[model samples]
Target: MPLLRSRLLPQLQALLDLLLPPACPLCGANLPQGPDQPPLCPACLAGIRPLESPCCPRCALPYPAEEGTDHLCEPCLRRPPPFAWVAALGLYMGTLQSAVQRLKFSGAIGLDRPLASLLADRFTDQVREFEPDLLLPVPLHRDRLRRRSYNQSLLIARVLGRRWGVPVACRSLVRTRDTPPQQALKADIRQRNLQGAFRLLGPLAGERVILVDDVMTTGATARECSRVLLTGGASAVAVTVLARTPRP
Candidate 1:
């Protein structure tokens, strides 16, 4: 009876799959109806390249070999960001951009694992370099969280935090204001828009905090969060993000 049931299960599942087919994440091809693999087609997954070598020491952009050393981007060398370090899971590009947008805007919470897994692989050493006592995802304003129903950053943070043995603090920071989207603003305007927007939830004195976020465009958000954490008495702040858009 056990053997029969086991044999019959796949046929039953296949009938259901035929009724309701699922699509591949990258190319929208129909996913096979079984536990053989992930929803993304193997061919598509193989073509998806992660940024592996001679990349930017900070932000992990694909750069020339000679330029990536010394652990500083040209911007960091000239005017260092407030956060001591930054790390990204992969270089942002075609399929990655779409995946990130889906996670952010289309309620594709399922993509969190793949994204976080990539980040975990890339930041192995940098996460250690910062030596955070805890991971704190950037706080979403109450209004936005209500509309979105989830903070994507926190989702990724939970995955990576569990793997890295670092505790995630989902409530240690509060968003005191709901500012306009940062993408439309200039650099100074972006910084000003976020000013006084974050506050510590409680005493974080002497705790080195790692701020996790989905994307970094201009570093304003991370910088703002670091300012709040530093003022709140955390020893230091380092940012971990899945992608960083190259500044135009």
Candidate 2:
């Protein structure tokens, strides 16, 4: 009975797919019928601009020019970040930007799985090398979390945690206070805005942590979160985001 049920499941899913085809979340285009197919379609996938080479080794900041090798950016040289490095799926532009904004601001929670899958596919090798034991999402202040009803970063982190077989430290790091939004603020102001905003719930015994977020704009948030984690006794911290904002 179990073997028959297992064999019939695929055929049942195929039949369901034939009747009610899935649509691309980004573009609303009908997707091909297949269990193995990605949530996004080929066209939308191609539209996402990947963050390629010629980037900062530490922060993953893409240099303005397109023809150089990976090297340390000046900022990192002057003052190093708490995290060892950053991994991102693409530059925050085009389809990727749209997807992130929708997931973040517009409450498209369903986008989490597809976005996490993309990140895993691109950075699996680097993440494996890092050998992270725990995943932590940048936390939302209780007030903001109440208003938003969901933390997109936490959602993404949960998906990645399941995929990589890592434990998610969901409440270990938290926002102590709600600050003004960072979207409209300048880089220096963004840094100050997040000052003393995070608190680590308990001490970490030299665990390697991967900080997950939806986007990296000025990177002030990531830096602050990593600092707190490191201060709380985390041995190493690395950041991973869905997209990275290019330098202006």
Candidate 3:
């Protein structure tokens, strides 16, 4: 029966594909027919610009030139965030931004697979180096979670954990309060809004955790989450996000 099921599943998937057809989530172009190719077309996939060298070693913000010096961003140099470092897949722009929006706002949960696969491939080296003991998705407030019916971060984190053989602690950290959207607020205001918003549910003493989120704008949300985790006795926290909005 197990062998029969394995043989039938592909035939079923092929039938579904032929019936519904798959289009690129970014551009609505017809995707190539195959199990090996990502849901995105070749052009859309090519447009994803991975963050490269000469970036802030702490924040992963791209620098303009290779000055031969690894310098921290002004914010990092001054106040310093709670997280030890950040690993972002790319800048929040182009097809990447579009894909994120669709998955986040439009209820396109199916996009999770491709996006997560992209992230895993892009940040495999950095994530391996960090060697976090656990993966935690930045939680959504109860109200927001009910309204959205899902946490996109958790979905992405599940994929990463499955692929990397890391255990994901989905409920270890949670949002204690619902705040207004951060995109509309200034950096200082964003920080203020996120204050006391997150809480750690279990002890993380001396454990390294990786926080997953869909996007990092001012880094305020990640900062607040990291603070709570550290206060709960986590030795260190690193952030992993799909994209980073360039500093204004």
Candidate 4:
């Protein structure tokens, strides 16, 4: 009975697909349903602009110039960040930007799977090299979490952790204060805004951690969180975000 059911399941799915094709989550384009059907349509996938070279290797900041080699940006040179580096799927614009905003602000949590899959696909090699001990999502203050009813970062982290076979620690690092939203603040003020906002739940034993977030703009939040994690005895930290706010 089990073997028969397994064989019939694919045929049943195929019949259903032929009757009603699935649509892309980002753009609503009709998708060809199959075992290998992508979560997003091809056009939407192409629209996601990758964070290319000629940018800061440390922060993944896209350079204004059209072309050059990856190098340290001025900020990294002047004041090094606590995290070793950042890995992102794409710049926060176009399709990627729309997707992030929808997932974050519109409560479209289903987007987490596709976004995390893309990030994992892009950085699987780098992650393997980093060999992080755990995946940690930047936490939201309880107040905000209560209002939103979800932490987008945590959702993404859960998906990535499962995909990468890494353990996820949801409460290892937490937002102790409900800091004002970073998007509304100036770049310089962003860091100040997040100062002492996060706290490590407990000491670590030199675990390498991959900090996960939905998007990164000034990186102030990531920097502050990394500082706490490092101080709490994490050996090293690397940031992974779905999108990076492109420099204007």
Candidate 5:
């Protein structure tokens, strides 16, 4: 009976799928009927544009035009961030933005899987090349964590760590103070707001760390966290995110 049930399960699932078609989370479009396909439909998935070359090597900020192989944005040239490098999957717009909003504010925890998979696929070469010793998610304030019940950055980091065979140190870095949302503040104000906002829980001496997060706007949050990590004895720090907000 067990063997018969196992053999028939796929057929039963197919019937159910036919009766109730799956919908794309981003656009509410009908997803192609396939057990192995991602929850996003092809149209919605295509809307998430991947980041291309000619970006700032230090911050991964997309440039207006192709600007040779290696270049630095004005901010990086004037004052370099604490992290060595930044990599992102795509510009923060279209379906990518929608997905991030849903995962972050709408309590869609399951979105992390597909988002992380896309992150890994988009930057597997870079991650392998950087070869970080540990994966660190930007820590959230306790109050916010309590309210959200999860850190989206940590969720993405956990998935990437599993895929890349890197160990995740979720507790090593922590947000010691609650600060105003960076998005709500100007670049300079954002920097000031995050001052002394993070603390290192343990030694990261001589370690190469990769900071993971959902999105990068002005990069103030990543900078602050990287500063803390560096001060705690990390040799180098790199950043990876699901999306990056293009500069105006």
Candidate 6:
């Protein structure tokens, strides 16, 4: 029966594909069965540069190893951001940039699972180490959530929580003030823009929490969340994100 089921599986998938063809949510390419269902093609996937070692422990910037020195990157060293620690899956350039763009702007919401799964798979151990009492995603203003109908950060937090055995509190944090987008501002301006933006919704006493976000560019948003969480009586605040844009 097992062998019969295995043999019929491909045939069933073939019928399904023929009936309703699948396409890459990013590029709209026809998605075949087997390994092809993972969304991004090999060429596109290969362009994603994962953040390997020799990175800033605080900001997660991929840095070159120097002689007998393990220190911060320029952006981290010159003016450190507030988070206690950070871990990222990859660089926010090339294919990763486009993938996030498609997911966030183009409304290709189907890609969230694969992307979040990839992030969870890579950071499962680290997520455990972060020892988050509860997973909290950066909250979107009601207006933005109404327009997008989804928050990719929460999607990622849910996926990571399931994989890492950490419970998620979806409404743990609230965005009290609706701020403009962070992508258009300089680091200093970004910091000011995000200040007093995040606040705790319910009781958060002595909990070790980690803030989950889709991207950490200037680290301002995460820092603001961390500050809010700490002020709310969280013992420690760490950040886990999908990408970190290195200084150009």
Which candidate has the highest TM-score of all? 2
TM-score of model 1 vs. true structure:
0.78
Output the better candidate (1/5) by lDDT.
5
Which is the better candidate, 5 or 6, if ranked by lDDT? 5
Query: Roughly what TM-score does model 5 have, to 2 decimal places?
Result: 0.88
lDDT tens digits, residue span 1-248, model 4: 99999999989888888887888888788976666888789999999999888789999999989878999988999999999999999999999999999999999999999889989988999999999999999999999999999999999999999889999999888888998898888898999999999999889999999999999998898899999999999999999999998886
State the lDDT at 8 in candidate 1: 100
Ten consecutive residues with minimal summed lDDT in candidate 4? 31-40
Candidate 5 lDDT over residue span 107-180, tens digit each: 99888987888788778888888879999999899999999999999999999999899999999998988888
Q: Which ten residues in a row have the lowest lDDT in candidate 1?
A: 61-70
Over 1-248, each residue of candidate 6 has an lDDT whose tens digit, in order, gives: 99999999989988888888876556667665675366565666677898877677888866655333346877767877666788787889998888888878888778777677778877777767767798899999998999899998888888888878889888989898889999877767998898788878776789998888988887888878888888888888889887888765
Cα displacement (angstroms), candidate 5, residue 220, comes to 1.1
Clashing pairs in 3: none
What is each predicted model's overall lDDT from 0 to 1?
Answer: 0.79, 0.92, 0.88, 0.92, 0.89, 0.81
Candidate 3 segments exceeding 4 Å error: 1-22, 33-35, 65-69
Residue-level lDDT of model 1, residues 1-248, one tens digit each, is 99999999989878877887877766778776667646366665665556565655654545645443445567666766667777775556666777888899999998888678767866777787777899999989999999999999999999989878899999999899989989889876888899999998898769988899988887889989998898888888888887777536
Task: Report residue 156 deviation for candidate 1 (angstroms).
Answer: 0.9
After superposing candidate 1 on the true structure, give the runs of residues whose Cα lies further than 4 Å from its correct spot.
1-71
C-alpha displacement of 188 in model 2, angstroms? 1.5
TM-score for each predicted model, relative to the true structure: 0.78, 0.97, 0.88, 0.96, 0.88, 0.83
Candidate 6 accuracy as lDDT: 0.81
Which residue segments of model 5 deviate by more than 4 Å?
1-23, 28-30, 33-36, 66-70
What stretches of model 2 exceed 4 Å from their correct place? none
Better of 1 and 6 by TM-score: 6
lDDT per residue as tens, model 3, 1-248: 99999999999999988998888876788888886867578998888777777778888777777565667988899989999998887888887888899899999998888888888887788788888899999999999999999999999999999988889999999888888989888777999998998888887878899999999888899999999999998889999999987656
lDDT (Cα) of model 5: 0.89
